[model samples]
Target: MESTAIGLWGIPLAILAGAIRVSTPFIFVSLGETITERSGRINLGLEGTLVFGAMTAYAIAVVTGSPWLGVAGAMAAGASFGLIHGFICRWPKVNDIAIGIAMMQFGLGLAFFLGKPYIQPAAPHLPSIPFGFWSGLPQIQAALDINVLFLIGAALTFALRWVLANTRIGLTLRVVGDSTDAARAMGIDPHRVRLVATAVGGAFAAVGGAYLSLYYPGAWNEGISSGQGLMAVALVIFARWNPVGCFLAALLFGGAGALGPALQSVGVTSGYYLFYAAPYALTLVIMIATSSPNRPVPGMPGALSLTK
Candidate 1:
């Protein structure tokens, strides 16, 4: 039942399973933040957006009995929040960071108020593809039970990477991110582009939320996120804002996240709690390594306020 089936081998297997399961949310959120940052704006408020999206997805699934609809609702809610953040930040003298923080608080408060009724309801869970069906072992089957959204997010990472490198829209986004003056010179509306990018980013973040409530944790609660949305910021920096890199970084973080449970499954009770903090420790290490003033991070968008 535990990691006893395959002896010590089950530890890595459990971690692998956990990595695939836990990394889905990170994949989506990091990719979303990558897009937003690539457009020269930052949205720290995605933490709020992620929680609200989870609540919206859970409530919608309970009411509509359709997990997909729940995902859609979450996306709409997240996008709307992104649009609001973009619009408000566009006003003179308004800081993006300040607006993002304000939006985060507002979203959390709103979600808590609206989500109370949904705490007791059970919703339809999202389906997963049994990639391990060929195996007779239950452990193997369970380990290979990959979710549909994980596939979608994985595919989207490569797709997004290609789009950013090859498309006109990508060019415009890159230009806007690199230099506002250059975007204006090319007759592009930087503000409008950023607004749209932020919205798109929010939609991606909400899908991550959908994955959380509708799949993994499979419930609605105030504490569902556990800062995955916020941690995505550091992830983006670690990956240098590349979509493909984001996907891989997410898997690493996910593996780290899975360490504790994997250890517990193997009957190693001692200090397993510390293993849960592996992802946070990884984040801090990445930040320290990348934040040297002498050597600026390459590939960082020049126009991003993070540069300032």
Candidate 2:
């Protein structure tokens, strides 16, 4: 009876651990997407941006022997990708969403091409904080090895939430996203605002990718990313564009992602491949539940193309 109770408890504990392990990328990417979406531009190319960022980060870390440098490199690559997307979108008659998809393909190609050499090289990994030191259990200690990115992501979420609600710059971004014409009328260049926002968004997304390659999975490969970047976009919607909500939604996604493997560990033998669909299925269900036929939610940016 005690063993049975412990086994049941392990499920929730494993879920929590999975959340910690998996939520970092989701938080960063969703937050980045939030910024871009808030500025009336969407970078669907984040998938590519993420892959390229991972490759850049891993390669740089391998060369420099510093994980931090890899993060910086990832940010630089991401910003450059964002700038390209922004520049293209600024051109008259260019479809930003379509451009984003194109960028993703381009990024993937570049990553595969460049990262080919670094596939076998090992890079320095980011440091982790062990919060479970006192638990005296190997599983607990492993579970509590929280990555720095998770803390940074959490802090950024609070900071962004505060900025969007109170700061002058946030107000400008909101105006630019809600109505480009209004922003232009106020002498604020919507293009400039969007460009900056997208750049910042890309930087965050890239960091998420870096975390994936240099920490969690901690390897360089063409298949390092598994739709995390794209799913993050959907997560942004499920989060209702709130940074804090993004954090919570990310944890949910992480749990969904962990379910299949965790179940397999416990001798459960049903629908392994289909179990992988949990996160997407949940996202779809949430979207259906939240969407309305009449009007947009209050916090949603007015100019967001997705909402329309």
lDDT of each: 0.91, 0.89
> Once superposed on the true structure, which residue ranges of model 1 sit more than 4 Å away at CA?
none
- Cα-based lDDT at residue 249, candidate 1: 91
Best by TM-score: 1
Where does candidate 2 stray beyond 4 Å?
1-5
Q: How accurate is candidate 2 locally (lDDT)?
A: 0.89
lDDT of 1 by residue, 1-308 (tens): 65566789888898999999999999998999999999999999998888889999999999999999999999999999999998988888998987888888998899999999999999999999999999987889999999999999999999999999999999999999999999999999999999999999888898899899999989888888888988988899999989999999999999999999888877778997789889999999998887878766889898897745
Query: Among all windows of ten consecutive residues in candidate 1, which has the lowest summed lDDT?
Result: 1-10
In model 2, the clashing pairs are none
Error of 1 at 241 (Å): 0.7
Measured by C-alpha RMSD in angstroms, how accurate is candidate 2?
A: 2.1
Worst 10 residues of 2 by lDDT: 1-10
